[model samples]
Target: MRLALVLGEVAQGLRRNLSMVVSVVLVTFISLTFVGTAILLQFQINQMKGYWYERSQVAVYLCTSFDGGPCEEQAATQSQIDAVENELSGATLAPYIEQVEFETREQAYQNVLEQWEGTAIAELASPEILPESFRVKLVDPNQAEIVIDQISGMPGVFEVKDARAFLEPIFTMINTLSLSAVGIAALMLIAAALLISTTIRLSAFSRRREISIMRLVGASNRFIETPFILEGVFAALIGSALAGVALIALTEFFVGGYLAGEITTIGFVGTSDALVVAPMLLGLGAVLAALSAAVAIRRYLKA
Candidate 1:
């Protein structure tokens, strides 16, 4: 049968170039793993942004002992606090602020105690030393700088800190890592493509006599090309399958088991995320291999 002969040719090509096939498989595996890591990191970042940013608040720390900005080495008075409250509620900055919660010194101190519970640090905290502050939630989290600028020089205010500022550096680091992974994946894929092209060319060269005889008998281009294309697809599929396994293990053991245990604050990608990415990796590998084989055959193994 035509299908059987094509499969036979594919098997022969693979057996003849087993080393190159294995190399293609390994390269595709590593490259796709990097690609999957980048995607999962992006997903994790989006999840964190949705969870943290929605609850993010701008903390306006009132002066306890005013050393510099809007403070005179004295505790903030009730009138100054009330003035801040009025400003926050009035028309000028009201459009930016969603709501505000005032925390008293005792409450702030209690929060510190709770945070430092059972630690030696708790003993150093005192309610009198803790500055009373206002927690301001913004209508748009991106508008945090606007709130910070408005409240920074105001009386009774020590400094305005946006909760998002604390998170930006961390997120920025994650994004950089994701981009790095993408860059690495791209380089590996290029290597895989070149390796595939070389393998197909070698296979075609080895079978040149057969190809010549078939061309003399008027064999169609599709019939001649199918075996080589299938060989590349077979090698790539193996690599892609290995990559999928590695991705699943990574998500399960590293992200789910290790990271989730260490940082219980945020949810991480799991096996399901790997499953979502696995099929895409397989498809990408197959497509890359097929295209590379076709190009190599057309250019170097022409009938």
Candidate 2:
């Protein structure tokens, strides 16, 4: 009977400030959606690093006639090539090097041709413009810097490039985006909290007479406050449910449907990631609402 009465008071409180309750719900929905997206984006970023870091290699580019630095206007001689090859298989670098694939100037030019087949840039491309290189697959991708330091100062090498350097900018951008989502979510959560507080205060004020009568009849603080807290919880529950649905749609259509087709090279987040985040969002919203309501109720009673 007491549980039924508390639930009834909760429903009554929700009806008194319908617009404010709706405002709290919308704010919570938007906030939690941003929170969920930020979490999944971080998850995707971590997965991308794990998947791509293993494949990243270091390129040791041999000098060409057209190249600057170390070449002095002459192509790499056969002796320089031999020296580089010997150094690669030698005792010092042998531990770090997993496998080495050599690319000839002609092979490089054909690759450029196929890559820029129909472009105007292809017309100006020549074998002499591109440098032949050894693609070194390292035993550990993290050991790339060591290989670079050793190979960079070697004769006939124009540049030592780590492929992982290319991925840093992409990850940096994703991280920035994640931080931005978190910022937006923070602001919206504050709005939700304030709205929840305001809604509780209004409900309390409207029921002030009944509350005083209950007090006169020896009602406990828990009995008076339980219904008000439940009011916030119910609105938050609706908002959380909506946020969960939005996260599912985002994963299904945005990551799975679109990004999976367009960017095939990198693995994206899946529905399971969203499902994992849904419960977290629900709990977070509930906590925010409950705290806000408790503060409002305490302050209103004292006032």
Best lDDT among the predictions, by candidate number: 2
lDDT of 2 by residue, 177-205 (tens): 99999999999999899999999999999
**Model 2 poorest ten-residue lDDT run:** 66-75
Q: Top model by TM-score, which number?
A: 2
> Once model 2 is optimally superposed onto the true structure by TM-score, how far is the C-alpha of residue 100 displaced, in angstroms?
1.3
Tell me the TM-score of model 2: 0.95
| Worst window of 10 by summed lDDT in candidate 1 | 65-74
- Name the runs in model 2 displaced over 4 angstroms: 114-120
